[model samples]
Target chain A: MFTAPLVVAYPYKRTVGTLLSRFFQSLQEGRLEGTKGSDGRVYFPPAEFDPVTGRQLDEWVTLAETGTVVTWAWQSAPQPDQPLERPFAWALITLDGADVPLLHAVDAGDMARIRTGSRVKVRWADERSGGIRDIACFDLLEGAS
Target chain B: MARRDVAIVATAQRPNEVGSTLTSVELILPVINDVIAKVGIERQKIGFWCHGSCDYMSGQPFSFVAAVDAIGAWPPIVESHVEGDGALALYEAWVKIQTGECDVALVFSNGKTTSGPIDRILNLQADPYMVTPLWPGFDSLAALQARACLDAGVLSEADMAEVAARSYRDALNNPIAYAKENVTAEQLLARPYTTAPLRAHDCGVPVDGANAIILAAGDAARSLAERPAWIRGIDHRIDTQRLGARSMTESSSAAIAAAKAGVGDDRIDIAELHAPYTHQEILLRRAMNLGEGTHVNPSGGALVSNPAMAAGLARFAEAAESVFSGSADRVLAHCTSGPMLQQNLVCVMEGE
Candidate 1:
């Protein structure tokens, strides 16, 4: 029997392209933005091109941080590198003013607190970075089921 | 000119298991040898060699290159590798034969899931900028999709439970299946959720395994096996990788592939769906429109013995095996790759 440690590390430095450049830049500045597709649907975290028309999108639409959870799954056991260490719900939220949903975590105290249509808002990370983690996770809003 | 005829003549696989002491080449060598022996063909006669595997799962780069040692690439064999499931490689081989380039081709795949954290490693396949940064495990992403299907009334927990129950029961007869039991849907529903809305039963048990398939064209296929599973039609399609851009409840790509592959043109006796998740089985059945007449997952499907890179090809082998065994006249072998069935391959095989 042979035993050896295997470590594969390939550091990647990628440039966020034309459309996503503005989106990630806005995230770092505590603002959310989406691009309008040719079909007039706003896409948060802005896609480089319209999914339906395959047309390049340049029109940017500012979006609100607050959003409604379209659907979610409770992560009772947190895995490494997840948004949250403790239990949380992974949600697809249709942020206000965006037609499409954004996948993020909801810091609902328990699974009972979050549902399909739960109202939630983004909780920006303390140390800001131009990445998806800029929004640490979504915190469930009070007075909503 | 009419389309070239291609058929799967022989196939071999190891029993799915959680851990393995064998290296990639060691895992693959026997299956390749077994398949070649089953057909009694000389290795040099194998026109092209196509391998399907993930470098990430192997914990090393150029992993497939090392696997070629198992094939003993002498006289410089023409070979290609796909960083996906073996079903895709089978598609490539099918095309190779159609081009009149090869009369016979060998397609093989291996996945040592226990070598690494497969769930986390698969995240790298997601959108590097958006989805991958979140590091959402595949199971978590699948749970999100399952919840959407549940919320949309496309499927229910009970429906998912029933799929698992049936798969588990079916696996009892499958010697190579990793998970097998005589379980009931009610019993499965009683189990707690591993990821809410998804119990442990709902997800495929990952295992270390390898599989090999031999493909012969036209008359070459006729002389190879007593009954060769002829490839009638095969097609593969992919949906948008964006999690939010598409509908979670349905697999449009699968429906398109099934339609193009002529799944509904005639009666299907059995279907081997590469659905690792129970909800995905239901989604694929609906997408492919596989009705009550089809015996779904008689080999217990991937939910019982999912070996990542090899599972999809196993579906192909299982479906063809049924045809070769004269159990069914026509069968459908479906393979899904990426999250939420983002990519789908449909192969309709039949007996002469």
Candidate 2:
């Protein structure tokens, strides 16, 4: 067998745009922000326009760090570059006030602890950057089981 | 203006396999030659050529440009390409015929999924800022969808295992299929989960392959094949890109596309659905309203051999072949892209 290093890279930069700019900016401050749609639904990861109406949304809502797991799949063995190096649950979490859920990894210590509707809270990263990784991952809330 | 009738006259596909050392041109040339030979058509006489493939799949930019060599574009033939599955390219060819610009078109697609980490490569399709940065692989995302379907009571682990069991049993008849066996749901459930709630059999086996199809309009179609699979209706629709925002248990886009494609207007004798996961096959059956009478995935579908970029178009070829063989009068062929059946294309065909 022959072997060689094959690296696929996109070296260019991209603008995060209006809604995401604010969302990421908030992440740097250890806070979460969402966009309020014309239908009064708050969307986490803030969409620039309402999904149903296609209307521009600029209203921002401060979101809680805690949320409930809408759905989850246990990753028995995490792959390279994934959020967690060890076994974890990849979950869709609906923040306390948001109608839509955001996908992220949950460090629940073991598969037995994670389940649908389980409460979780963000575990902030030590170094804050204007990115989703600012909140490293969600952790199971104490005494929620 | 009344649209002209178009039909798939000829089709060819390479066997789905892993670690194919052949180049894209090497892999595509034989299929292209075979399809054109079946239709008895000259290379220069072909009105238009369209191709579907992703550069990221081969880890080479403008990878599809190399495939033009397979068709010998030196005579300056009309050509185009899509950075997706070949079914979308077939769609463009169908539209071209409707526009009265081209009477005959050739559509082809190929991919080497075994070249790299396919699961990680597919993650690039997710949202760059929010999702891709997390590097959530396709299998994990599919597992989440399966979990949601389980929670909603739309499907159970037993149901998914049954889909796998049936597909494996059916694939025994398919020469090109990679996975073929006579297994039971109980046997599959006894196995361990690769990703929670999803066994290895629940997912499609990734392979490297290519497929080509020849589409002709009106008189050209009638003269080419004894019984052509005429396109009755074709439509494509997509749901939200946000995986968390959409309903995981149902495929709204598939339902919409099926209705627009006139799937419910007639009794579908066969359905070749491109569902990569076992639960997804069940979900799509519900979305398209395909009943128990409809023969689903007779060629074993993607659950047996799923080659990225080419698998979707293979469904079209498989369904049309059923018509050509006089096994079915009306058939429904479906293709999907993105995560959790987020985007769907439904093409209804009939032998007339």
Candidate 3:
């Protein structure tokens, strides 16, 4: 097969907003929380305003980091500036405090064994100052006492 | 007046440069005036003003607000902006004319790809949590789709090269085109691949430029010209952004829009298609039900020059301009966004 040129796009700095700024800041302080919205959806990232009801959320609570991996896709070739240097799986992890799962990378070694309903724990990066990559990738909690 | 007979009266665009070292609202300011001057219409006569641009593209919010100053939008004109493509903005203005609310409207799109690596900026549109953090960038993600297309046998490397040859050949007639006097498709294939199954020819030249299209309705449209090209129909549709879940080869959104816009009955004399990539043009042509009788992308299509949000509207403008000049009686136009036309819009125009 012949080869051809391709064009691609990457990420640039985007604004997270005041409310999300606080939420992300708190997460960096070794804290975890979910904010309840009037629309009845508990958002882990903390919604500045309810998308459904158009109401603001001021309340929050600390939640457990343990969650089950609902589904995942293995990123065998990590792109530049990604959190992990090696192969990882992008997973929708349902943290204990939130009803819905949050998407994050998992340290799942291989795609074949990263099955549904895998229990995982947040492996916080040594440097955390609030951002999605703060968790880096979740580690398998299988043998942890 | 009923105001349903809105037509694109004038169109103007500047050359698309990779980084656009040019500055301010003035970058493409000269071209805007040139287009308006060709129509012999003053800018103040335009009743409605609208623009489509993305904040993420500029890496800042309300990036279009500054471009508005170029329009000299003072004393506060009725205006709006979309965070998406400029063609959608033109569609919004076109819809306003059809509704009898506004008689004339102006639309444009602008971006500076040189300010940052544009691929990184485009990732903001992806599934933020999972796909975005992985940072595949825009090309690799599209390459994944291109690879899928190859596996499905829906397209071949040479076919893309052929598309490039045909487009560049057509673009030779267009002075504003970016890909000018390029070599054969086989030679394009010989060039190294940027992503597997895709090449530089497969992608639109990254350009930073601004363009404006003006519209007129009913009597206002009539006064604007002796033979006005009227917008007969317009519609758009979007598919969910799950690349893994959706059909990889077909553009369902464009199909839905083509049906909604009543494309089946009209005789497409000339058609302009916005296919940022070569294979997508094939998908969109099938989706729009375009036939051999119809001239597809005589303006060299997006393969020649794409002003991001502006490319789609340029497709519409090109279709209308062809008819306006008495080259064709009826025409079809298609605009696309996302990988493989994840979102699509169709507009049919006819000359009186």
For model 3, the stretches where C-alpha displacement exceeds 4 angstroms are: A1-79, A83-145, B1-3
Off by over 4 Å in 1: A1-4
Off by more than 4 A, model 2: A1-3
DockQ of each: 0.84, 0.80, 0.10
lDDT of 1: 0.92
Sorted on TM-score, highest at the top, how do the candidates line up? Answer: 2, 1, 3
* lDDT tens digits, residue span B1-352, model 1: 5789899999999999987878999999999999999999888999999999999998889989999999987887989999999999999999998889899999999999887888889998998888998888889889999999999999999999999999999999999999999999999999999999999999999999999999999899999999999888899999998899988999999999999999999999999999999999999999999999999999999999889989999999999899999999999999899988999999999999
Candidate 1, residue B222: Cα displacement in angstroms equals 0.2
**After TM-score superposition, what is the CA distance of residue B102 in candidate 3 from its true location, in Å?**
1.8
How big a share of the true inter-chain contacts is recovered in candidate 2? 0.75
Residue B270 displacement in candidate 1 (angstroms): 0.6
Candidate rank order under DockQ: 1, 2, 3
- Number of clashing pairs, model 3? 14
Candidate 3, residue B118: lDDT: 67
Candidate 2: docking tier: high
